[model samples]
Target: MAGLRPTRQRIALAELLFSGDHRHVSAEALHGEAGAGGIEVSLATVYNTLHQFRRAGLLREVTVDAARSYFDTDTSDHHHFFVEDEQRVIDIPADSIVIQGLPDAPNGMEVTHVDVVVRVKKV
Candidate 1:
């Protein structure tokens, strides 16, 4: 699902993101995957394409830390289980959690959405 014209690089990135089941991936990981798949694309291009896709409502970005973010192929409302050891994210069903008593937003601004990332560590 692309809002702009299908450029070659965009098409390639889209294939990597959407060709399989819904999942999350970082730009660095996706760059590696593209290389392994014989698709030559720069890391910068991957980041740009991911942001573009997010802006176009084709993907959702989950920020795990200030230095790391994962682009989720599932754009629907859902929480996540971030496994620290594996460095992977798995979907937590949207209906499994409920939010309550949210304070009002500032004037002229609205809450677009809320993301819940529950960190986990294997014992």
Candidate 2:
């Protein structure tokens, strides 16, 4: 499991996040889910926990725009499909696409990983 101390709140949120199939969640949306599930928690708490989880390598943060972000439980190497009409994120396996463009990293720097978000909308 993740290395953080097993606090009650963290445990509850982790259950909500990892118990089900891997999926993406925004803080506000997750806070709503917690409330509906009868878990007493706050939005700020959710945000903080999410940041902690990201730092701990338990979740991957995906930013769609300045105003919205999502935490994905599936931490494997993969890209994404941002479904605009539904405002949701879906996983895209990394091998399915080939990236051709290239720019060398600056001296003393190296690229760790790449994140690709393909925006899609229904016509």
| Best model per TM-score | 1
Each model's RMSD to truth, in Å? 1.0, 1.1
Residue 9 lDDT in model 2?
Answer: 87
Model 2, 5-35: lDDT tens per residue?
Answer: 8888899999999998999999999999999
**lDDT string, candidate 1, 4-121, tens digits:** 7798889998998999999999999999999999999999999999999999999999998899899999999999999999999999999998989888999999998989999999
The lDDT, on a scale of 0 to 1, for candidate 2 is 0.93
Q: List candidate 2 stretches off by more than 4 Å.
A: none
All candidates: TM-score: 0.95, 0.94
TM-score, model 2 to reference = 0.94
lDDT of 1 at 80: 96
Off by over 4 Å in 1: none
lDDT of 1: 0.93
Q: Which residue pairs in model 1 clash with each other? A: none
Colliding pairs, model 2? none
